[model samples]
Target: MPLPNTSIAHALDLADARHWTRQPPKRPATRLRHLLRQTTPSALALRLFAYPHTLTRWAEGDLDGLTPAQATLIEREIYRTWQPEVRRRAHQQILDHGGCVTAQLHARFAYTTRSGEFHDPRLLNVIEDLPALHARHLFDARHRDAADDELRRILADGIGEAYFFCALPPDQQQAALTISDLHLIHFHY
Candidate 1:
């Protein structure tokens, strides 16, 4: 497939990541404690655009019954829920491990359905929706396969709005509109 349209993507090379570190976490437990700790929010949010989260994984799987609009919302919730994870790992990599990763994929999508008008992929977490999602997830899961499909689609097709917000970088690094012939939208990793 075509490389993910560059708009929703962010690239942090070893060089770019080098300056973003702190001392590596001494224990995995402590590492887990650092997420959403304020210092790491903005940076991690930026990094999220590139790292492949649950939503990305879904796109890569069978999307026979999914849609971009559904993908869009599911992506948002999944994206929001991942904040803590993203922060902690960022610490491990940049802070603890010298930011040794070869790169980060934030939310770069590689494929998407060519159908719907783009959905807004920007995260509007309301900051307190984590618990709400957790509560609803069980209920949603009972309805369909996509039950767990996306927080963004039931919920991330449930994600993009690129104006997927993530798919469209402010830099215009590349254009965001990568209309495709497929149904499920997949981001670059």
Candidate 2:
């Protein structure tokens, strides 16, 4: 299928190349036992994208420390397990939405909550609620005063007005939009 997004495609490619040349440990049975003892399916699934090599080590029963190449291979194997049509449709949806934050959040929620079921109606309900959930998350992250009536009034009034940010009182503006140092650096660029 065509690449979903340039960055994801590049990362996948790099992972594949790294996995191809990895060597197994000499004592395979012992390594496998060690890995299996430590692994749980849920943990494996969650780490599949970010730490593919760790999963590969468990799968291969490899006691040797993970190498960069092994991680790449693990990523390719994870990708191989995905249903091609589902992945293609998901990619298209992200692309269609211009890869906005909301689109990415939806994709993440879908991936993290996936079970053996396909297109479960309950899943759609969760997706429909994600925007409000995300907005609340942002609010919670920015301000510690979620329970304050004054804060609620400020948000209710400010959000509906033009120049919403500018309309906020100085203290309310700081409370509502105070992103962390990490985000400041990210947004700066």
Candidate 3:
């Protein structure tokens, strides 16, 4: 696959250094700092280190502010870490789209929880978005013997969909299955 026509310099030019500098440090920023220190050239790494908050902001999805070279280096590092088949496909997609593919992949798989930890995308539809009312009903009936004080707590802690389904009465289980099917379709679609 052919690389995108967009030059590294141009991509770097798209970043807004000022905006990144003003943001506070967060997990993404911290992770990006770590990646830079571990993978980037020492001088470039030092330059980014001087603006820790800004680096964090960039890691959190702010493309602006990074130099073209810096962006290229980061992208390369990310690509290098992927499994061979995944890397090949991602490279093809990036070439086909004429830009970065990691961002799209990251967005697809990344689901932030209420507590700020990344949630599994597979569990997102059934658990994360299960309505509080429905969850409460499930807990009251299906999970009656369980010690948890609240349905929300159980869901947040990561209950399996199969367990929840099996606990439901036959009719409710069917209903739950239907609801889950619809949710899965919607999520994948």
Candidate 4:
């Protein structure tokens, strides 16, 4: 889909007419930031019906910020229009303390599994395949140097090597250990 051609006044008028009570036009940047925060590049692609590259450029610090009016429209029409169950599951993924607890509960409440017979209502629902989402992220990182650099930067600055190491899969963990050892021997000797 083509990007919506919307002026600030037009978007404000749309919001006002649609009964959005927030006085957003006066503080436009805040509204834009809020929408940007809600959406990831992939999520934005899904919402905007745009290619991932368009959103990727924005995410990679290549594009300028979105207009407040455009942001407001996206938040209202795309993000808010997301199904409630999807939203709740996403919330639970972040808010739930332990994955084990949520996994068990989800298995009990929303799914049944047997040998070659796993059943899940959420499978038919949007936002259910978190495992697949996670796997896609892993695949992306493995294939993309930019993603690897981003992951390394995140580990170095935010999460620390230990946390990042712990988060890696067993095979990757072994590889990381070998690389660390090589670096240590090269520098420390």
Give the clash count for each candidate: 62, 4, 6, 0
Candidate 1 lDDT tens digits, 101-160: 222123323333334345445423221112223223322432232322342332222223
In angstroms, give how far residue 58 of model 2 lies from its true place: 6.6
List residue ranges in candidate 2 displaced over 4 A: 1-8, 11-60, 76-81, 92-189
Would you list the C-alpha lDDT of every candidate in the order shown? 0.32, 0.33, 0.35, 0.33
lDDT of 2 by residue, 1-189 (tens): 433332322232232233333333324333333334556545553644435455555556564665654454344434433333443444344335644222120110111111231222221111111233333332343234133233323322322222224455655443232111110000000
Residue pairs with clashing backbones, model 4: none
lDDT of 1: 0.32
> Local error of candidate 3 at 121, Å?
56
Error of 4 at 120 (Å): 44
Please give the distance, in angstroms, between residue 127's alpha carbon in candidate 1 and its true position after superposition.
Answer: 34
TM-score of each: 0.21, 0.20, 0.21, 0.21
Task: Give the runs in model 1 whose Cα sits over 4 Å from its true position.
Answer: 1-67, 83-86, 104-189
Q: Estimate, for each residue in 92-182, the C-alpha lDDT of model 4 and write its tens digit.
A: 4532443310110011111111223222333111111123333233223423423334433222222122332446566543322111100
Q: Model 2 Cα displacement at 148 (Å)?
A: 52
Comparison by TM-score, 1 against 2, better one: 1
TM-score of 4: 0.21
